[model samples]
Target: MSSRISTTRVHEAGIETLQKRQVELAGAQERLTSGKRVAKASDDPAAAARAERALAGEMRAQTSERAVEASRTAMSLSETAMGDVVELLQQAREAMVAAGNASYTDNERRGLAEKLTSIRQQLLSVANRTDGAGSFLFGGQGAGSAPFVDAAGGVQYRGIAGERRTEPATDLPLTINGDGVFMTSLTGNGVFQTSAAAGVTQAWIDNGQVSDPSALTGSTYTLQFSIAAGATTYAVLENGLPTAVTAAPYVSGRDITVDGQTFRISGAPASGDQFTVQPSTATLSVFDTLDRAIGQLGTPSRTAAQIAQGNTDALRDLDQSMSQLQGARAAAGEMLVRIDSETGRLADQKLANQSERSRAEDLDMTDAISKFQNLQTGYDAALKSYSMVQRLSLFQYLNT
Candidate 1:
């Protein structure tokens, strides 16, 4: 069956076609303007989520990069400071050698002592060094103030024994403890320092070097010498508890091994003379070592033997101190390397994340422009076709 065609229906269809073309043109315009393929979440939810996650990780990497920078600065400062300590100790050793010359008078020795005193003060200043923000560098966890303080005999370490580490990467420690750098003691001699007990004048004591550092128990020990059976004998005490039932024979020029540490006793001693041994702790003050050097080289009326012992002990202690500084410098260098490596890794990661995010969210400008032009041409063709269709009539088509 044939039905009559309505002109209104044709015009309506043409209008609908124009409207659809207009919507397409609007969407193409939006993409070109915004420079993003998915400006709205509904455009591509999964792609949006991927881009968001990548951007978040990039932010975290940027934060870690900042931390690495700070760690690098800190490590640099530590390395330089340790270098300064090494130089100062070397100077002190050279001064000790000069003081040993017999040709130098007592006044000359006093002059050398004054120089050493100045050096000790300088060492104290170094010990109390601070970072750029005025925080103590060697304060361990106690960064509030100076770590070393003035005490009765010499300077003492007032800082806590620990470290502050930075996490530039997961589970990585980027800082070293101050105790490890400042207070490293090996076993042999100087396991404990020696001094003449109160009310005793028959013997002079020198703080020996550590021979075997690992076996020390950090306990207090005492050595008391007495004359028995026409021989000098000494008793050992550990923390005020008797270590032996009877005194051991004191032999001159023999090494006394106690608690895995070896100490030497030489020369004649009076009855009731005593010496004490204090266990080495995890930390030692560079200033204390310097102060001892100054005292040893400065004191007047020191006998030749006493002077010789002091020089020997000072040299040994200074060598150990140098080792400590070197170790610290090496540690700082290693941390610097870690920071640099991590920073490079973070930079590369950020670049990759940026690329990923771009792929997920950013528009391809060339493709977007091309699409806009194509849609514009299509819209123009639709408008022209719609105009032609509107002018068409049933009689006109039948005649053609």
Candidate 2:
């Protein structure tokens, strides 16, 4: 049996074929002009979704990079401020050393004190330095104004005792703790402090050393002197309780070891004179240390022994302050290193995100142009075929 086809059906099928060809050609042209394989979600749902995710990731990476830059800038400024603080402290130390010269008269000592005072002011300024954005470098968490305030007692840190951080995937610190760097330094030799009793004009004590670390009780001790029949003797008392060294022969400039602590008492100590030793505490301030040294230097009628004692104590405290500030500066340097590492990581992430998005939606131009030409040729052939089929009427065929 043979199948019969209607003329209406033939014409309709031919027209539909041409319309489909035109639609494909238009799609190819759109891809070529836009340079995107997936211009809309309806074009390629999966590819479009992937591209959207990659774009979001790329934007996040960019935001994080910006945050890293801000962190780097703030940390660098903070580190520089800390360095300036160290330098100023060194200058103050030099002036303190010069003040200790025995040959320098009272007026000369006063001049040195003035230099230290100026240095203190400079240090305060450094402590309150801003990050060029109205934010303090050592402001800790945050501050509406200056962090360090010079009051009647001494320099005080008004900021909170912590650090601010940048907002991003990479957590980074933006400030340093001002209290730890400026206010909370260990007193004396960072172990024990030695001092002569008040009003004991004849005796002066040196900064004590730890003779035996294991034997230290961290207790307060006193060395009391007594003279009997022209024979000077001293006793050791631990926490106000007499030890076994009662009435021991007293020798000036001799090492006195009590409870594993060693120090020297120079010059003749009158009967009833006493010296005290206590554990070192973190109650010293950099500014307060300088202030005490300045006060001692400016005071007149001080004995040679008193001057020597003052110098010894001041130098010890200054060394402690320097150590503390250096530690803080070192921390800032470490943070900078971290920022560099984070920057590199973020750069790599951004590149990966860009590549992912390109792969998901970007067109391969060479393949795209070739495909477009093929579609154009197919559409032209379809147009020619449609024109020929439409002209194939029965009357025309019969005449031929």
Highest TM-score against the true fold, candidate: 2
What lDDT, from 0 to 1, does candidate 2 have? 0.88
Candidate 1 stretches with Cα past 4 Å from truth are 1-12, 145-161, 167-180, 183-261, 276-278, 364-370, 390-400
For model 2, the superposed segments whose C-alpha errors exceed 4 Å read 1-11, 394-400
Highest lDDT: give the candidate number. Answer: 2
Instruction: Please give the range of 10 consecutive residues that has the lowest summed lDDT in model 2.
Output: 195-204
**Tens digits of lDDT, candidate 1, 87-205:** 87888888888877878777887887888787777777876777676666777766566777878977776777777766626323434456656655542243565555655433555
Clashing pairs in model 2, backbone N/Cα/C closer than 3 A: none
Give all TM-scores, in the order shown: 0.78, 0.92
Compute the lDDT of residue 203 as modeled in candidate 2.
69
lDDT of 1: 0.74
